[model samples]
Target: MKTSLRILIVGQNGQVSQALQRRLAGMGELIVLGSSQLDLAQPDLIRAPIEALRPNLIINAAAHTAVDQAEGEPQRAFAINATAPGILAQVAVDLGAALIHYSTDYVFDGRKPEPYTEDDTPNPLSVYGRSKLAGEDAIRQAGGQHLILRTSWVYSTEGRNFLLTMQRLLQEKPQLRVVADQVGAPTWASTIADSTALLIERWQRGQPGAWGTYHLTAQGETSWFGFAQAIGESLVRQHKPCAMLEAIPSSAYPTPAPRPLNSRLDCSRLLREWGVSQPDWRSALQQCLAGQA
Candidate 1:
């Protein structure tokens, strides 16, 4: 948190990356890059741009985020999500810089009845989840000042997420059957960025939390069906054509990758450690929709 703090964000146009760019605008000298500029798939090339920039902080927001598609290509997913993060960690450690990486709730099998805590063992159900878990482990093994935040059901107006898809589908179709069995919080990307900005301020002012993994997500839980309902309600309020949403079980709609029945993550650790708490999922969605308007 020097006056001339240099921050390297390893993504551009991604949900979290875009938000981070906005929230951290005046915080420091931000060097943001897209795939063409920084390819995580090519590990050998990652070091050059990072080392050249010599940033004080490295925020890695890039990843192979395609869940079902990852099942078809495990190596590609691992390359971007796992191998690249480890390399970034090593480089950050070498440069004496702090690393912040985003992870997923997919790391859990979602068999637990209650919200998953930091202590819960990860039993990933898909290749994407395994790759992300591997990335988290790799960063930990690097032994640097790092914060791996596990978030779930991330959505924004800008990216390809559940919210955007739902809004379009609800408007276009007369009826929609949404899966109610799978549950999690619909976290806004902006929430993550704002919290990250506050964390940087704390670290800079000498009131930093422990450097480790923590669950960072919106406060509350709901199934996919519940979330879609919320979105549909918003559309109705706007006097737009809305779909008749039907709640159904997961078995009714099968995918290439399995989804956890319980995707809720306990964010108490984040609140206790960093003094940061997120708005309720519904509230965050309202804010996002308002912003979209």
Candidate 2:
């Protein structure tokens, strides 16, 4: 049953990319490239490596994720997040390879009271959000078999994420203020990578129709305050310093880019179609912390 698929992952050190590397190690001839090898900021440079690899699957896990910084450098954001993905998709099509790309929940404007569905119209609020949405559209337009997995509040033990930030700040300060109005699931990078592996396994077993956009995130919703509190609880259980978390509005902590107040995504499509379910945010947080320790 060993397929020996040639998998080309277009990122190396990112949270999700790292998790993918770990999860897909024995499953394929995995070749991971970092910015040094494949710079997404330069779209023209993407085709050569892809053409050379001629992989069976191309996973574009690289993206410009600096929300606040993207406001100042819109061109750089678009270059990496928008243009490069299109190039990758086209190359994948030419090579007749399946593509898997990651997107964000920021495509929504947070106007809907309910969770966002795949059928919902996208109204991006920030430059970064717009750029990510453009990438999704570009991939679809390339006429290639692809999966655009949209997720929110991504974090891992080994990256520059909210979880690691809170862990550091809690030990440094006595109390921490977190945004309560903005809500979403804090998805662990490992969860995404593992779920993706399962989906790929299904495809290898003749479920090729799973090619499309799907919302993949932790099962429950929580504000930044709730996520911080959960992190604190996990630290306390592990005999680490825990901070007193205070719930504050998004207005209290203004940033350069506007964040969607509602990042909760309806992931029933992933469950119904692929039979894949993610753990609750709180439980995932605990498991992530345990790995860190």
Candidate 3:
């Protein structure tokens, strides 16, 4: 956040990373690396690039994101999600650079009836969740200048996400069965990137207290069914064909990794501390579709 800070983003092609590439332009000397340049799965490959770049800030947007796939590949998940971040945090500490890492709502087991806060104890339900939680713990334990922004239901037009998947499925099938019991705010990647830029600006103003875990997502919450219905409606408005969406329970759509029923995160802390408020999910979606058009 310094006037001429060099920012090294850890992921190159992921949804959030791509959005960050667009959003963080002209803000700093930005360098984005993917697995080819800095394979996070190989912990040995992480520190050297970071040390060579000696960036003023390191934004880690990469992770082992396959939720169900992680169930079969726990070791690979932990290696990238947990171990890599710890190493990166240590490197950041050595270089005296601040770190901004992204985490997920999956860290919570989804037992709370209401929205989960930062103060709530995390009880991850699956390998992916546990791995992400581990990365958060590693960053905290590193004791460096860092911000862990926990978000939920991330999607974008370009990446492999729910929005894209639904767009494809809706076109292919006459009807779709989406889980209704599970709930969360569908956060757009660009929203996260823009909000993050605001936080970076605040940090540039020398607000040391801005470095901490905060719930950063779109404003409103909805179930998967509601989300699908909204997406279909949006597609129709755009003159695209969309399937009939049906509400179903989580049990109906079985997967190797169990998803959280309540993925809603309380984002008051971010607003209270940094005055960063995101648009509602529906509005964000409309904007995303408009951008796509």
Candidate 4:
């Protein structure tokens, strides 16, 4: 890490990657390579470009994140999420570059009543989660200076996510039924990018090993019904009304991939280590909605 670190951001088109680009603007010289240039499936392709750039820091935002789709396509998911990340970790190790990787809350089974911490033993219920967990293990096994940030309910102003999905359903139907039992935090992409930048700054400061798995999400928790209601309320306030959001059980709506009943993550380690306090989900949602407008 230098005064102006030479950085590489993988997955340019993804929401998280795009947000990272915006957050790192003017702070460092960042080179973003899309999947077209360096496909995660072809691990060998990464070496040439990475060795060429010789970046001081590498942030991997690329991932096969389609949850349900992963169930049928486990190999494809593992190829990009698990195997590719392992290859990247080795490359970073060879180059002695600090690696920043993103993970997910789905790694846990969501059976616990309390929020999950970084130290909790993972029991991923879906293929997507298993692949992500394997990726984390790969990074750690590579024995490199790395940061594995596990986040939940990622969304943005522009992207296919819960927020946009709800908005679309609201448009098509007069009433929408969302699962009210499952609990989790709705984290904005911009917030993750900001927090990432702060972590990078800390990494540059030469602090004692802040390189470990940490769960980063918005401050509080909310169910799908609660989240939808908040969004509907916002839409009503803007006079752009939508469908009536209704609460229902998980059994009411079934999907290809099984979802966790609880996705809440504990953020104590992140707060203590990075000296960062997350903004409330309501506030972050407002920022996102305002951006949408």
The TM-score values for the models, in the order shown, are 0.99, 0.98, 0.98, 0.97
Q: Choose 2 or 4, whichever is better by lDDT.
A: 2
Give the clashing pairs for model 4.
Answer: none
Q: Of the candidates shown, which would achieve the greatest lDDT relative to the real structure? A: 1
Worst 10 residues of 4 by lDDT: 202-211
Query: Residue-wise lDDT of candidate 1 within 42-127, one digit each (tens)?
Result: 99999988998999999999999999999999999999999999999999999999999999999999999999998999999999
Query: After superposition on all CA atoms, what RMSD does each candidate show versus the true structure?
Result: 0.7, 1.0, 1.1, 1.3
**Model 4 / residue 191 / CA error / Å:** 0.6
Q: Would you give me the overall lDDT of model 2?
A: 0.92
Which candidate has the top score in TM-score?
A: 1
Separate clash counts for every candidate: 0, 0, 0, 0
TM-score of 4: 0.97
Off by over 4 Å in 2: none
For model 1, the stretches where C-alpha displacement exceeds 4 angstroms are none
Q: Which 10 residues in a row give candidate 2 its minimum summed lDDT? A: 202-211
How would you order the candidates by lDDT, starting with the best? 1, 3, 2, 4
Q: Candidate 2's error at 179, in angstroms? A: 0.6
Q: After aligning candidate 1 to the native by TM-score, how far in Å is the CA of 122 from where it should be?
A: 0.4
lDDT of 2 by residue, 156-262 (tens): 98879998898899888988999999989999999999999998888888875467899999999999998888888777887887878889999999999999999
